[model samples]
Target chain A: MSATADAAGPGAVRFALEGRITAGTAAPIWKSATDTLVSHPNRPIVVDASKLEYVDDVGIALLFDLTRRERPPEAKVEIRDLAPNLATLIGAYDPKKFVPPAPERAHVGIIEQIGRATERQIEYAQQMLGFLGNCFKAMGLALTRRGVLRWGEVLDVATEAGANAVPIVLLIGFLMGVIIAFEIGLVAQQFGAVIFVVNGVGVAMLRELGPLMTAIVFAGRTGAAFAAQIGTQKVNEEVNAIHTFGLDPVHFLVLPRLVAATLVLPVLAVFADVIGLFGGALVMVGFDIGFVQFYYQLLGAVSMTDFLLGLAKAATFGFALAAIGCQRGLATGAGATSVGLSATSAVVTGIVVIVVIDGIFTVLTS
Target chain B: MTEPSSGTTQMSAVSVRGLRMGYGSRVLLDDASFDVARGEIMVILGGSGCGKSSLMKHMIGLYQPMAGDILIDGESIVQARGEAKAALQRKMGVMYQSGALFGSLNVLENVRFPLDQFTDLSLEQKNLTARMLLEQVEMAYAEGLMPGELSGGMLKRAGIARAMALGADILMLDEPSAGLDPITAANLDRTILSLRENLGFTFVVVTHELQSIFNIADRAIMLDPVSRSIIARGKPSELRDHATDARVRQFFNRQPDAALEQAA
Candidate 1:
């Protein structure tokens, strides 16, 4: 192939091409044309291809590059006297070299930012409520039909989420009791009323800390687990597969977790309360208070109302945690990162809901 | 192998010799051998769980064979280490069954990933290169879309673009036609054929789809689950017509092989 360039005018150049412009010969011609265009910037270039024999896709791409180059204003390109077949081929190729860049987003004001966040929150709350309603319906369906609930799966989930959680709950509850008693006893010693440490520990453990701590642990452990497990199932299309088989995932997967958490958490919380009292007893012994005296003071300080209220809080927190977890899981997006994000969101939302509900319970009781 | 006039010998782009592959003690394939010539499409054909994908994974160094070696362009990838291994790895690209595109990245960014990791190209050049590759696969329109936003067919096209990003001499694809409709699958086969003709890259495709096999395969090896070894090796039409093995004949004709069922 031969390419001959001639000056059309002061601001224009024309090239005459001949012979085949296949992949082999297109590169050098392309390089020379690009070099010539660079040297003569801001000039109209025309290719008179009447003598040209043939041009392939790569050859068309080279010609298209002339029009697509980043040049100063006043630079233009025109192809003339081209064969109709080559023109048709070039049209079909339609090399896109001048796609516009995406527009930069402007910053939003604080009010708009807050408004958008609130909108998202409302949407999330609506979805969660819908999920909860479906769970209740599924629960009712399971109750009406025998063997629909999968008692084996329910027992498995209960064992995994509840029985398996005993050690961590006991450890955290014991540490929390020790920390509280030590801090409060130090202050009470200053007032010469160290015996009041037993009352404070008993009341706190029975009324607030036991349920709150147990709920937070459940949120971190069982709630995150539920999200990751269901999210993975969602990613792998296993959730959809279940639906195709006429099984409700809420009934099969979530109801077991919710029921298990509700049944198991209060028992775990009571265990935590007893363990926390022992922790308080240990602190009281360190402060020279007898175990008998501490036990009597604890009995005098805690009442049936406080114990029942704490158990109620525990059960409610359990339900909220499991619900949020299952909701986050069912709402999982595609891919692995979404699974991780679901687990994280489950834990975060579960804790937030737990704390908010705990505050409401406290207000109602007060 | 005879040396060709193109400055390189007519050696296989990939060679698996006496390959025994499996997990732990369960042998999936035993004493399997194959050669994939340069610039030709080689298809690994089998029914479900017949270890076609396992063999592809072993050849790609994702899984080590229990015995034997894999050679890429005369270099032993099975025994290669460190920089040598990385060099061999850079010579080949893999497209997984699910596309396996990074979910966080847009189509353009996912295509640019291998180029970014291996090349010193400028940002603009990288973006241009990615766009060009996407255009080749007809995915340029969806460059800004996330992997999750793409349909199954579109995702596979994007994956092929990404696999071609590094300009690898060899490309391995697992189930390129899986989950796609018949027309889309045929179009994908056309894309593979055109790409091979234009770019001259060797392809090692693992697929059970009969139409895809007949359309794109220059040569194919069918694995038999019963024997746990290659049962047929030839062109698709040849295997479909003249294969003496009843199992291989059943496979190409899409019939339920009695032997396979009995083995199961």
Candidate 2:
């Protein structure tokens, strides 16, 4: 429990340390050493531990502090004849206080930044293609194998993504149709062509607006929901757990959402089209156009080709939205921030993909 | 640090040297070092935000240390990459604080996870192994139940079973009985002790529960927030009784040790 200091010679001091070196024992020893060092400022301190019995983390910490103290440039501290276990303990508990500086970054030109961006976009494209390919393979497997697909989960997702979304989709569609009819009727009245207002609303709602509006609604609602659900799973390591089980998350998670969205989007689009036409019919009756004339004109203007094309586009858009949302979720990084980022990116990517596919479809059809 | 002597000498399951841990520039622990001997249950105890779980995470390779290296079976996990890293990872299984079981998977399937990933065991063999591990944890009756359907104690048991799926030599558990009742926590401690005695796998458990510490720990290390390093290390009872540091004393005794505040 005691540390005895001896003045061996000028400019040198030796301390023989014995018994336990613990929190209780080290404090007195530390004071004695500090007193000795203050008396002989320029001397080299030698601590002999050959007779020491025990040491703990606190004891090791005290020794480390002693070794790291500021002293004269020529002064040194040394510990000798330490027991193997004590030495190991000291080595293990000693802290590395100095931190290395971070590596310097090289300057980058604009071209390099552009090149990096392009490379990132290309990589992202490749990943999306790979994911789509996996989805197709999973869908194929589901078709070939009777029980491989989680039909119950698919139905659940369908009810959630489609049936639950009906009210909002119909509301937005009806409002859009009413607005288009009113705006066109205001101009048509000046030229005595108010009857033609029904034609304008009918073409827009049936061929383009119906599917596009439904897809956008689903993207914001269901796609974001998919991202949030899967992102949370990723953060919780449940996704990793799935991987650990030798199961494909894309097959188990993404496939169900994809199947549900694709199956129900066309139905939603058809519903939106009917509701939007009814809105136009409401406006048409105000302008002295009968329900029969409005119905006849809507039928004449919107053929089966336009209606089927819109449904087809709705299905494609549904697939795109689901793919983007699930992909964002599956690719989520760790943390709470990443979950929000996944949801945000899912909506953005889903909308962008929907718009691009819609443009391509319009060009091909026109 | 030099490698421990091999063959005749007892080997440590995990060794940490000069560990500096923190986020970015904010250092939480400096000069952290310790070792868990093979087949020993080492409890990491600390006050809240003292980096107990952080230290465990570093040891299990969840996050890289700010400085210093961790070695498992004398191999430096920090320096290992690719196959070496994967091999090292395979030797250890981590049970997260939340159990982290796949919600979609039943208890049996959760336990079979590691086997499915790393082994060529047939479906029947995997199921049998999963059931056996579940039975060891007394969770066999809940084999068909989902994680969301389990109680706190049941989740912990199921998590332990899943962690044992691959027969990993080391298990790292982050607060195994954190939210359990006293009776359940004691039962978990007994389960851990018996598992250690039977399976001979080393465990590194991060927890602040005093009873569990005294019950299950072969050796324990207490992390001090003020020091930002280990302040005490020994058998839990030995530390509780003989620790000379007031902070250590305060911790084990569940005291405030605030004489100055009382006087004021």
Candidate 3:
């Protein structure tokens, strides 16, 4: 055993074994080794079981028992310098007993820690896909069992994600239309194509601005709300309570919000389109553009394809906001800061998903 | 109702074989094996982070074991399939360390949860059953109150009531009396014993309270926190008399044991 310790290098603790370790003598050695590891936490511990030692099954059993116990993550435990016979005996007792020590500087340096955190973030993101798949499965099961999703919960989300958001979407839609029409109409009048301003504004509002504006509103309003609600529940263990009750949390919690958002966003976008058109027409009235001609040209420019496309975009945007919101909510930790962080991240994620999906749709259909 | 198979008549309520569990590189439990007979109330005693809660979670299917299998009525939870897993889950109840009652749900609604999930009972029937369970826990008047409205003891009572709602054969409690006053906790201990005597339901409880273990547990499993594994398992008195593991001795002695002396 002494010769074996010498071979394992200087990073080992050598102990002198005086006599044959019977059933009774093994307990104290085991205690000594485990106590050393526990007391000197945050440092590598190498137990050198070298020197005149003859160990029985009891000694081997005690050593194996210590190996199975939990150690602090930062602590490194290693068995060094075992006699060949003793090593084989320990190996046969538990072949999977080998745990190499943690590398030095596992937690040292801020930059390296940040890099590790980013890797963890990426790993978590990959795991999130599996989580989403489970949620979708749970959603399907819930729908099959319940026959229909809860409209009451949907209404609550719509109120927060849509109705309450209407004022802002409307306000922004109106200002954007007025600004675009005033600028575009001035340029078009020079070419005697003032009526084309109606066409330009109408098509843009129906096909793009309406959906984009409503999605942005949802990202800020519903997205943040989702993060806050779920985050608070996560901290409070309401989510775990749901699980303990034999209900899948994904089905019970995620589906209702998903269904609600899907139904509400398209409706909100339609409202935005109307407000935007009216804003453009209001500005056109100042330029002496007849209401009758504006309505005629607007109808011509905004086709069925335009309306359908906007509606599709709305649906996609709704799911994005809901998915991002719900994901952020589920990932929340048990703190106020964690909840706030999730909420902020949810809104940011919602907007990013909305823009990326919109761009994908535009590229595909165009 | 899904009837229990006659083939499983010989099965224990929960049987763990060569079980191992850990978080990442740090092993919390290794080669731990035990069995709990039907209608037996078994309590697990351990200091903080000794894998008591983790073991309970594995037995109830909340966690997948890294090695070995936990059998719930002879079917391995680690190997159980879709409906089988759900069936296993339906047969057991868990009361978490915090009681884990839903803040969004009132006491009555929380109790009704298991009934709502697995049972075909109507809403009215569910409500009636929830009320009866609350009454048993001496909280009939508190049914309309939300979790926040209830005190700590009241919340734990409500959680226990919910755990019993499904009539599950195996009931797992993680620190059932944690954070309650002595009187309230003692009352809970009495309630547990009474339920075990009357209902013939099996219980696997993980608690740090010596009083609760002595009063309620028919058999006990004690985990050594420093080792992160079970150092002792037997009847409470047997452990008190015969635990040779220094950690186990320290645990029972409640003062410094051999390990502390060695460290000093």
Candidate 4:
């Protein structure tokens, strides 16, 4: 394909377009044609389309750019021998349109970058607080009403996010328990107080490690899955479909996932605590601390208040993680990359929220 | 054209019988029945939220109908299971409204995916075939581009190539003209016409564009958002000329509800 520009008259130029005017062949022809048109400002250009066999949108855009007139809306480009059907396309487009936007600055200072980042974080935190308010309001409304919440979807989500996650959670907890007891037992051996290792393991498993570890695992696994699922639905217009049917997405989609996470996390943490203690006790045997002595020591080291506090932290962590995941998902923009971004943001945000909330709980309890 | 008392079982390529679709208590389509004769180009028309795309989704087996059956090649898709369901899927190919191409795959690979999954064709053969299909849609130039890089019209064209990769007898397209210019949209219509004439492909297209309707549809059915049923069905010309229902005539004439109210 060749595009040739020749002077038709003193103030007019004739451009002959040949062969395919598609993305594959439009580049050099585009550059030279634009260069020609831009140099000869305000002069009318004649585009000869008689030789053109095929043209796609890229070709259309090229023609528009070539013939594009500046501001006051003067039509400068005329086509000779364009097929009647192709004429309809040109008719739909304004010759004055398609001006290239001014290029943005490529660089910003380090201080400005830091300032912008800080501003964005502040905005994000503000939005998250608003979302929390909305969630609480919706929950209150649902409890007061009959048909607001979908218990079925909650059950389904709970099974997937909780029941299916048991094996992995238990495995991680067991490994953590064994590692902690082994390390502490070694230290206690030097002090000739190996039985005291049971107290350390017991308190850590119940009051700190169990809920914290389970929340972290949930952030990585269930939180990411929740974000991806909802983000894809948003991308596909499924969430919009729910909206068009006069349903609030927060009430319909988010609530079920939130309820599921909150309900299951405490139960999961309890399992983690029990299995972790079991693993720690087995490790205590290696230090010549018998199961009976270990059990009595664990009973004394951790009280019901400690156990309840851990479960409360687990529940709050679950709520925060699910809310963060759903918020990130609902905030997803267009394209496949946005869905991946939302999932990544969800896991990162969920873990951070879990840790921050855990710190608050620890301070309040202490 | 002589209408048949004896249509569907032996005569039509697709027969959707008494198909009911709804989400929860909100019914979108009810008792919707239609037949598409072999090699026919049928257009489903509706206003926004009238479930035109949803109807097409049901036909593609993306959603199960609330009631009734859709038969493709005289086989019931609603009741099919396992290999039977898989076989039914092989006969029908779909292009979604979003042109849902796999983000990770380039144009050529996306088109070749069906061939790879369903056929024992060699890699070279699959590549050549995919290239040929892309050429048919005027997208062979973009074989190396990822789905994300292509423009909306290009993405639609690539999706069409991928849908045709299976050489399925029935091709369903949702809003094929949505992102295209008049010239490109006209070209697409011509492509559909050419494909139908040459290969005897049956096309079930969901589009609201009247120009496209006139250009390509052999038969047209209008779904009414208020009525939740097919309000009009005939040649697009016939419906445009002589439809008696106010909503059908209003849609045909592109009349606003306010204008109708003023006239009354």
> lDDT: which candidate is best?
1
Go through the candidates in order and give the clash count of each.
Answer: 0, 1, 2, 0
Query: DockQ, in order, for the candidates?
Result: 0.24, 0.02, 0.02, 0.06
Interface RMSD of 1: 9.4
List pairs with backbone clashes in candidate 3. Answer: A1-A50, A2-A51
True contacts kept of each: 0.09, 0.00, 0.00, 0.03
- The residue ranges of model 2 lying beyond 4 angstroms of the native Cα positions read A1-211, A214-223, A226-366, B1-7, B257-264
User: Model 2 residue A145 lDDT?
Assistant: 91
Docking class of 4: incorrect
> After superposition, which runs of candidate 3 have C-alpha atoms over 4 Å from their true positions?
A1-366, B1-10, B122-124, B225-228, B256-259, B262-264
Q: lDDT for every model?
A: 0.84, 0.81, 0.75, 0.82
* Candidate 1: tens digits of C-alpha lDDT, residues B1-264: 001124645899999999999999999999998899988999999889999888888887878889999999889989998889888887787898889899989899999897677655455445666776687778888999988789988999899889877667689999999999988788789888876765567999999999899999999999988899999999999999999887887888777657557635
Candidate 3 residue-wise lDDT, B1-264, digit = tens? 011122455469999998889788778888889999987899888888888898998888888888999998888899997988988887887888767887667788899887676655445445655665676677877877777667878878998889887767578988888888988888888778766654456899998887778888899988765666677888887787687766666676675555658834
* TM accuracy, model 3: 0.48
Indicate the worst ten consecutive residues by lDDT in candidate 3 chain A: A1-10
- Sort the predicted structures by TM-score, highest score first: 1, 4, 2, 3
* Model 1 superposed RMSD (Cα): 6.1
Writing each residue's lDDT as its tens digit, candidate 4 over B20-132 gives 99898889999999999878999999899999999998887778899999998889888898889878977787888878899877888899898777655455445655665
Interface RMSD of each: 9.4, 19.9, 24.7, 15.0
